[model samples]
Target: MMTCIVIDDEPLARSLLAQHIADVPFLEHRGSFKNALLAADFLSKNQVDVLFLDIQMPKLTGIDFLKSLQHPPKVIFTTAYREYAVESYELQAHDYLLKPITFERFFTAVSRLQVATPKVIETPIPETATTPEHIFVHVNKKHIKVILEDVTYIESIKDYLKIHTTKETLVIKERISHFIEQLPNPPFIRVHRSYIVNRDHITAFTQQDIEIGDIEIPIGGTYKEEVLNILKAP
Candidate 1:
């Protein structure tokens, strides 16, 4: 079992991560701290396998704290900001999870740490059978239910996202990358840094862009290879 701890300045964030760690079968929750300093003291004495750490904090940032350690445990940075993604990976962080994290995304990250064990391999479930059909987004002080099948594409606007569905467009305070975690990948794919399109809604595509109805979304150069490969596959 991997022993883990959460270190975040937000009480709610810490609580949420602790709960997620508890829900996972392979992870054991060791402790939760409000700051990296408190966690550093605990780490001096105990052996921790992983750390769910927040990037922005009061005195010391998560990145700085990890740099100070001579032998730091594998860290998974949890924060609201996406700017530090490159630096986090440079630190050899196990994962970088955005705020408003869902259980599905959290599980996907932690499952990478699971040890391989010989077992009967089972056939994968079909997308129609297993893909989540809907997601609730906090909008207008209410949790609005959005049918995944209705979403044509998602566009990033500053710190918010404009979710365009067949029925209407809903703007919400969330990062597109963070919101993508709630949707399954086969039907939902990020074609650009600012956009994610549902393959089901895509009517046509080229080397540079994709067409969904009358709307045309650019395929970012960085994402071009993977996007073409997935779209071209049988």
Candidate 2:
């Protein structure tokens, strides 16, 4: 269970969050505080995975309090004010909730936290200057050596994925879902329901398409925002 703490000056706000916490099976509400100081003390004495924070308080606001913590836990800011939205995200907060938070919104935030949670993989990746440039994959039950730099993109063919290299597009029988996780981040990103491309190899991008080599692939609408952010990173 994720140990959680609620910090709000108002009693009604604290009570509401406590009720919400009880609904989420995995969340264990430790206590509620009227100010950041009391919450800070509780945090020092115990462990907390998530913090339900209110931005406006008498002495010190939630934003200032959070900034004070050397190592703050995953925070979901709750406030009546809308101005703090961008500021909260800049702090890498889990979610931002406008006061009078509904059960559905709380549930959505919790679900998002699950995806964003950091996992310590047992098989550590080798320390290197660059992501793997060469790897091996079994294709048609035969072990095939592949150079990453030569790969233009990948396409999910139902259960299997076809890895496209400059010389050849090899059909690998491995599940697309599993292969996606194994693929390195950044340069390789899923741009559509069936396509993942090498960002470095991309020649041009538009609202509808991305150009890799001479091959043009349609960018899915759902992935557009993230794809645009990735493309803009350079």
Candidate 3:
């Protein structure tokens, strides 16, 4: 699911927008806030795929709020007036959803997000149809066999993950974010600013950190909530 948050002041505006988001099956509201500063702090601490922003806030205009981000996500500007429409697009907003946002328009913006999302290809093996164990990665001029369960974690070093398995760690050059597409979910979760861990391998954990073998990985501040929920879930 794509994590999202709404930044708007009016109670009625939030009520209406909340209904529109609820209509989308994939979106889950992380939370909502009235102040841009608070929103900025939340964005810094969390991984947000989409931002539903309102332009005419008191301290910070939505335009200025986005302009300040180092790496902005898909934005949908919400406001009463249309003067900011062209300027909003110039800022690379996915879509400008006018206030009193209709369900149809909201779906349109989400559909664009689907287009921008990365793609993956998976092939089923014969006997392992139910329990696929191995995957092949081309590294150092040869096809290597990696038992997925043996992997401890994957760390991003700019372009590639130094794939740390029980036997060895391979430095295969690929998109860190894109390469993550190849990994199976569930047993693994991206838990830090630059690391993903095999949840099954977690030996111990704390409110501040997790332990796997000799490694003590610190969780990102924003990812704490989901990490805790995953740990608590049956």
Best by lDDT: 1
Please report the candidate that would top TM-score against the real structure. 2
RMSD of candidate 2 to true structure, Å: 10.3
**Candidate 2 residue lDDT tens string, 59-125:** 9999999989988988999999999876675455777898789999999887767555556567866
Q: Cα deviation in Å at residue 225, candidate 2?
A: 28
Indicate the residue-level lDDT of 194 in model 3.
68
Against the reference, the lDDT scores of all candidates come to: 0.86, 0.83, 0.79
Off by over 4 Å in 2: 119-234
Regarding TM-score, does 2 or 3 come out ahead? Answer: 2
**Distance from true position, residue 153, model 2, in Å?**
17
Q: What is the C-alpha RMSD of each candidate to the true structure, in Å?
A: 9.8, 10.3, 12.1
Q: lDDT by residue for model 1 over 1-234, one digit each (tens)?
A: 788999999999988999999899889999999998999999999988888999999999999999899888778899999999867754657678999999999998887645221233498756677777898999999999999999999998767999999999999997554566567989899888789999999999999999998999999875798899999988
What global local distance difference test value does model 2 have? 0.83
| TM-score list, all predictions | 0.53, 0.55, 0.51
